[model samples]
Target: MGGIVLVNVPTSKPLPIMTDTLQPMLRMLWFLLHGILPLAAEATYLIATYYSDDVCSSSYAYQVHAVDVVNCTSLTCSNGEMSSTSRSGDVESTECSTDYVANMTSTLSDSSYIIVLRFEDNNCSTLYYGYGTTELGECVENKYQGGYSISTLNKDGSADLEHFTDSSCSVAYASETANSSAVATHECSSSKYVWYTGSAQEFASNSNGDAGTSFSSDGDVGTSSLGSSHNMNRGGEYDFPPPSRDSSSSDARALTLVSVVFSCIVFVLVAVIIVLYRRLNRQTPVETRSGLWDDDTITATRIPRTKISIKKLLCRGAFGEVYSGVFNRQQVAVKMLLPATRSNLQHVNEFLTEAKMTAMMDHPHIVYYVGVAWDSLSDLCVVLEFMEGGDLRTLLNKYEAERHPVGIDRQKATIALHICHALTYLHSLSSPVIHRDLKSRNVLLNHSMTAKLTDFGISRERLDRTMTAGVGTSLWMAPEVMLGERYGVKADIFSLGVVLSELDVHTLPYAQVKKQCRETEGPRARLWS
Candidate 1:
């Protein structure tokens, strides 16, 4: 009866029609807000959190439900986010569960709030969740809920069961997932364990031994764990931080103080030593001569000065040419290195090495290295103790020509003894030395026929036993050396034995059927044994 009595309706749409239109429009806006806007908001939050440190720490709290609270015990915070410390005794209401993760994060926003929480169960395990600030709001949740079947688990990959859902619902919350799931897991019978990162102090103690108690105060994020009892002794378990100061400024001060103290002590000690040394030295006899001809410089084994000068050339080798000279106004032999071939590294190194090694070895039995002179632009000159008798090979040749012969047995034994002593000294050096080129020419004799081992032109300290080099004269080379074997000190011993045989027999060990040196040869190059 009321519908029949209704007056003619206006041409405009009914109020219910307008209401329906607004309902659908509102729903579209709701879709944009709850679905699209929420997704866009989450994306922006992540971007903002990544660039900021405080936001990073705050974001981690949303991953778990309420657990972090004041004076936190059993609560965990990572990257700075926290949770409500108090537990919900019995969370039986499903309506409450809808916002369980949300309420937890909202409570952790306070600076004074220290405690955080995590969830774990027999069938399904829940982990820590934290909150981040959104552009639309300050503290916001980043979680959802779903469950995954344990049977569908992958072997090579891993899954994080962040949130659970009713049978009607589908998946877990994105906010609850870790930034990285690739972290290595150690397997137990029914579970895999992951490392729970700890504070900077704890991390430093565990990460490296050198970390020690010395630490920086920058508050960099770090991770370390405690496996033993909570109140256990920290002796070896944890590393405590050292005293803090401005490192750069404090270090400079410490270094300056140490330097000043050291310098003062050194100056006093040196002054005292100098005074004592001068007093002691003055008491001794004053030698009129101070140059190379002094008794200290020239020994009884030294040869007399020769009349010949640098105008006449004595001889020449691949690296150097020898001439006579007056060193410290006393007659001496000078060997001058030739300008090397531009591409010849071996020749250059050999020349420089010989001068350095000879200068270091100051012995009467060894050839005297009087002085060395060189510049970047010029070739090097090495001054030596003049050999009046010349080389052994030359003396032997002269004896053969003349009717009068030298005393062979006595001369040989003297040379042998002197060489053995020199070799022993070189072998016992801190770094064992090797005379790679051992030949008759390198064996020099004074007027008295006492041999002075000379020419370390190609010598090198045996860094280890084996060197990646093929060195030594062909005639005097040992079996191992000739074959380019990884020879040791034994190789030198073998070479020395060959030299002894040569001196006795005046012939090579392999002279009967000498094998021509070839590129490819085995360790058994010579069968002298």
Candidate 2:
């Protein structure tokens, strides 16, 4: 060098003075050649267009490149040769012939997108492999081995990715995220994936491959076809069809109606049974002995023995003694056979006949029969209504003692009318009855002063114009009955006349005859003789 000044270079130090500068220049050159140049050469910007149908109709767009993919429509690729006609008439292409599709950069569009690779032709109707994202690189690796035809991508992406082992993508072995790129090698090895949005994703398997059946997510739960139309929301929910009413529902309604009707019928039947039970209980008869003398004689009504209470003696007779009593809370007169008379069949018969006769008589002027009671260990008593006003004989005696008139014709007529009425009721029967003995002592008066005929001890029912000869009081007896002749109902009228006379006279009939009687008189001369 002619004009340059030279300094001594230290060889051992390897030109330490220029090492920093040269090293930097070489490092920058190497970085440019190794990093930037290769990046520029390998980088490819690709726009992928997808179609819902075949032949690239109804297409939407997605993008892909060498470094990463935005949206991948197909698995197959060439060197910038794979192209599809987009909606905007823009022809976008990618080179994936020598590389796996997932190795390329992908960008999904605002609209959903799916990748469907076909084996027969460019149309997606033939054998195919479906995928949701390019992360599944296995789908591209097996592309040639499986004979792919055409590849198409859907504009609407799926919410979930279902992977199937068959070409139809029906039999699902795995479920994955829609944006996942990891390979499903276990249950989904060599499987296809189908992207669904608003439809339910169900898998069906066959020996050939798994097939996909699509149903609206809102549809009834059962096997359904993917071809059914449904609306998909942004959240990937599907609005499915409503379910139909089947025979099972109808049968349930019918059963409910029948049950209600049966319940109503049962309720009505139970109510009716209850009402009948109450009615029968009310009508049930009290248990008591039927007849005092004869078991075959049944009374219309019977009073239990517990219902009678002896109060006081009311009167006495040869056949029985009458006592005031209480029966069923009402004052009553009870006539019981005397001990002395019990052994006499005639007196017992007379007492029983009185009860039987009064039991059937319903006249207002007749004493009412109130059934019978057991007065003592050996005595059976006949019960009758109590006469608070006593008998006509007592009333007449009270008038005589007070120096009042023995009888007013008006009072006598009223008493006579009542007695007549009682006799009429007894005689008007199909067979007339004759009261052999009638007198003031045998007539009773109620609290209201209404006269009632009583003392039916010797009464007889006359079938024809005849009567028993030996039954009558000597004073009240009809002339024919005193002669021991057969009599008729008129005998009772003759006895009634004597009762009226006694009421007027205020004394017993034939008082002189009774006073003059002596033991020496012959029995017939003292009476009918």
Candidate 3:
């Protein structure tokens, strides 16, 4: 008698092996695959196919399967998909089932393929499975580790994610809505959660728009049922999870870092511009010889040169010092070039130009230009009506400090109207004037709260559509001016709107826009907007 001696072999493996009752059968299959049997053929390519009821489309039951007879294919289901695929190298027919939402057929050869990815999305709504046959023996990748998709927002804390041994996903097959925020892992070979099966129609209707809404390009899940415009697969959904932070977190962190860096760089640039402007204003004696005070337009407003008894010093600028003084036995604010910048032609020219323009304007809402007086270039000064209430920004601060809550009132409206009156007169001229630097800082008020528009050095006479751009405070600048587009009188109108807002809120325009930008783009977005 010819008796074959047989050894009883036990399957031993590592801790995290996908090994169980099927291990013996897998071993036999592995042996059959390693040229052990003449009946076994060498598998050249890999393919996966699945049929789903709710293939991430509609709430109806329909069959959608993707077959790749040409190359690698990945099939994804809206609900949990768990159907073992036939290992044959050819496309095999699968009986359409209404009870199961996931039915996958795969031609998986022994781990000798390229791009073997089988992982679920971070949300676990879609599962990506299959191996690539584009280039065999080039690379080996296995993506399936743990977890499943199709996570609905569980307002409650519990998540009952279980599969059924039966075909249906109703109460009889252990179907649940998963009332937790987190996605639960799917157990492909566990006793409690036997196999993944759920109602696509029920899940889609109950997903609350939080459906695991991704599918494979190689195949579709609920496309036939979900005949919507969202049928096309989005870009970059074919890759695996990054080794570190996920895409959203990584992108947020990158954006925040960029915003911070850009903000710092902008702050530095603005500081440098301020420094350069001051330095440029303090010019050398060579540039001061440009006959700044000799200009006929400026000397036309000259008064008898007299000594000014400086009462007290007000604010100081790069070019001059402002002082509350008496001019011709009347209260007035005297603007005198700083002793250091007296010889600076740029400073003298700017002071004279402003004086000339102010003297020409005659309106109660405009700052009164007293007269131009000077003994020599060193003593050159411009006298104007002294505003007891100081600048509008300062007055507003004082009101805020006194806990004076500002509301819509006639007083506020009158002040804004006064500024508007001044603007209307300037624009009504033959060649309309554009107050490019209009802001609360440039608007002065007297004791009775009567406002006046001042500081017209940057103002321009617009003869045509042509005009300079980006000449106003960024916070108060019009949209067109802020973008460096050619502006007209409409730019001043925009600044008036901002001043109105300041009166209403008693805050700087930058303060309000910065807060709003924080909720949207960065604070610098408005300046660039």
lDDT of each: 0.44, 0.50, 0.51
The superposed Cα distance between candidate 3 and the true structure at residue 404, in angstroms, equals 2.3
TM-score of 1: 0.37
After superposition of all CA atoms, the RMSD between model 1 and the true structure is 38.5
Clash counts per candidate, in order, are 28, 35, 11
Q: Which regions of candidate 1 fall more than 4 Å away from where they truly are?
A: 1-309, 339-349, 399-408, 507-529
Tens-digit per-residue lDDT, 290-384, candidate 2:
35455333244446777888876655543467788898788999888754345456665566667777787788999888786553434667889
Candidate closer to the true structure by TM-score (higher is better), 1 or 2: 2
Q: What does the lDDT read for residue 214 in candidate 2?
A: 37
Measured by TM-score, the strongest candidate is 3
Model 2 stretches astray by more than 4 angstroms: 1-299, 343-350, 375-377, 512-529
Candidate 1 lDDT over residue span 291-338, tens digit each: 332333233223333322444346644446677777556778877653
TM-score of each: 0.37, 0.41, 0.43
In angstroms, the error of model 1 at 476 is 0.2
Query: After superposition on all CA atoms, what RMSD does each candidate show versus the true structure?
Result: 38.5, 57.8, 32.6
lDDT of 2 at 374: 50
Q: lDDT for model 1, please.
A: 0.44
